[model samples]
Target: MTLTHTSTGVLEFESLRDLLRGYAGSPLGMGRIQHLAPSLDRDWIEQQQQLTNEIREFRRVGGRFEFAGLLDISKLVDEACIAGAALETTQIRDLIMVVDRAAEWREIVMTPPAAMKNWSAVPNISEGIADFTAFLREFRNKIQPDGTLEDRASPELARIRREIDKQKRTIQESLRGYLRRLAEGGTLQDELVTIRGERFVIPVKVEQKRRVPGVVHGSSSSGQTVFVEPIETIEQNNDLVRLLDEEQAEVHRILLEMTRRIGENAEAIRNAADVLAELELQFAKARFAEDYSCVPVSLSPARDAASGAD
Candidate 1:
């Protein structure tokens, strides 16, 4: 229900609408009503068809529906999906129902009735209205077989994205700092700093320190180690090099622990995401339903003939 106008001078209407579509398309959103009703019987199917027709008719005229009713639309679609017999035949019908419902909601929002004007009218409702209009148009166009991401997104998803980005940046910067420390001879090593693209790390022996004069040529398990000169710096930077190795090892351990924790909490995180997503979608459905519920599909001529002529 909270809303903030963006610097672009656009209301969050499109964002809200996109969120509604997401809920309508999700398993939870679609499942709520049918799950509650406890019957996917033939009688239920007939009732849904009748409800669909009524919804269509309601749109044809200007009708105001409660927020609860908008969610019912998604429930109905989900019910139809569960109804089994000849349900495939009703696919187009169900889509048309949603489309008609969505259009009705769009029109209502575009020119909401006085009773529904919960907020002060924007001085330039056009900018806000236009933004919402474009969103719906694009949303309708993008309604595809795969089920759009719009149906599942919520402000929470946006927040999750922001948090992930922040964490990633923090990790990146910490690594860079770790590299810089290694470069300033912060470690007691005379080891040369090697740079390869953005990756920064100091190479150190995992085993005992060894010095070789007269260009020692050797190989490890990987079979590729050669020296052009004596390895005098290795002995000088030994302690510093060891310090860097310890730091890198600690960092690596922390990273591994974090990954493990994430894996352990994967289900919890996913559940939290689903709840937020559903809430967002619910808000969207309610908002759209409220907005379009009262729009008149057809206009009548002015009652005052003189006013009409003017």
Candidate 2:
């Protein structure tokens, strides 16, 4: 079937598309709205109308549906297909969110209101959804919303972070003690311990730099004070830095593993994404109908003839 739109018809479709876009919950959904057009296939139009009618009835009975994290991950998925490619923490998190939202939507449709159950029986609506959801569970506790690996992401990471924390506390305590001694001796420029260039240091009077017997990292503007990393705490600081580096490496490994797992399921993930996008478009159309009190208009023979002439 051939479908053609005149200038006026195109304008009207654009206006409707804009209205539907407003109801879309994700980028994928909005893109679908932007490409939406009147279909010449009678079956396709009838199916769309039926879906919208079902959604309207579901909404009227206080049914609530929310879709989140529908960002397009096609680029990331494409990247994942490359050899030895790893997704960043945030990218993996976003993918997980997409899978999670898809699962939620499927569950809702599978258990629709009794009055709408038959309408919800769209063939293969939940296909591959469960597998994608199960795959995402591996990352549930591993990744944080901010795209950082959680301490619980791996036992090695937890251990490294714990050691890092211990070393930090030890360094802080030793630095405090040194600060107290310098203050007592009246050689300290400031009573506070601060960090300069990632090294914990104390400010000491410039003339008393010899008394501190440490590395002079920086000097104050007036040259009256110098930031010194005391020799006594140098070992602890080194250990802390080493532990921090190890923590970072462990987090990277975890992210790599997560991304590899996602890559393994790339096809399934893509399918799930397509299903979720389709559901979002249907829901947007249903919501547009609800908000605008829209009913499907059948073209009578006369109207059809008139449209043909135009």
Candidate 3:
């Protein structure tokens, strides 16, 4: 008879599953533990036992195996597969991590330690994995670890960012004299420079806003101080905004091209994830078995298995 939900709880099987989940390294591995069911099939039981035993041995020999840092990129891959899509920095970073992990997997799985060489439980997963070498190299060349594109990502992007930086330094220098001028006029509410609606502005007394030729952005909460962008900095701020817009366009273009590259191997990526998840699940099972002093038991042909395990 199949174990019902109530029976599972009473038998402490539910709690056992919860304990097993703690041994898993990733969401995918934990999901496998969560969906586990009691099985009576002799072959299936034997396979599970053998795979767990292999992993225990694999670890005993100082061989490392886990899915610790692997992320669930299936959703991202789905979005990347869309035509003409442009992924943001975080999304691209996730993809890069996956590709890098795949590269590591290729090396380890293909040439395992002599102790694990005869084990068929962990087979070569390279065929299921896609060749992301070109993509990985290109992404590394174009992107930084901090979610920013390198200056060489594109000529126009680099040029625009450079100009933006130069203009910002100029604005900072100019603000000093401008703030001093306003502070001297008794029109300044605070001797500071701040941004309002993306333009640099100074806080001036409400009545003094007309003291200088400037645009009124907003006012402080008390409404006593109004933020005004002096007429002198308007042309400079406008240039900065224009350069920013160009940088955004270039970033968008690069992202779309990268997304298209990801889409080209979307199917293979999913398959590779499945292969990794299965390996992780087996290792999790091994660790769980070790912690709980558990062993797989095969039922007799007459279905009269040892009463103790049940």
Clash list (residue pairs), candidate 3: none
Candidate 1 stretches with Cα past 4 Å from truth are: 1-241, 290-310
In the range 1-310, model 2's lDDT, one tens digit per residue, is 5357685385687787787789998897787677777766776776777666766677788887677557888888888777677789889888888878877767776777776666743434656565455676688888888988888899999999888878877888998887887788899888988888767889999988899887889899998989999999888778877887898788878877887888888887888888777777878877777777778878443345566674
The per-prediction CA RMSD against the true structure, in angstroms, equals 20.7, 3.5, 4.4
Candidate 1 structure quality by residue, lDDT tens digits, 67-144: 332222333333333423122212323333333344444466567665444422211221221222332343243223
What ordering of candidates by lDDT runs from best to worst? 3, 2, 1
Q: Candidate 1 vs candidate 2: which has greater TM-score?
A: 2
Residue pairs with backbone atoms closer than 3 Å in model 2 (clashes): none
Candidate 3, poorest ten consecutive residues by summed lDDT: 121-130
After TM-score superposition, the amount by which residue 206's alpha carbon in candidate 2 deviates from its true location, in angstroms, is 4.6
Better of 1 and 2 by lDDT: 2
Cα-based TM-score, every candidate: 0.24, 0.87, 0.84
Best of the two (1, 3) by lDDT? 3
lDDT score, candidate 1: 0.37
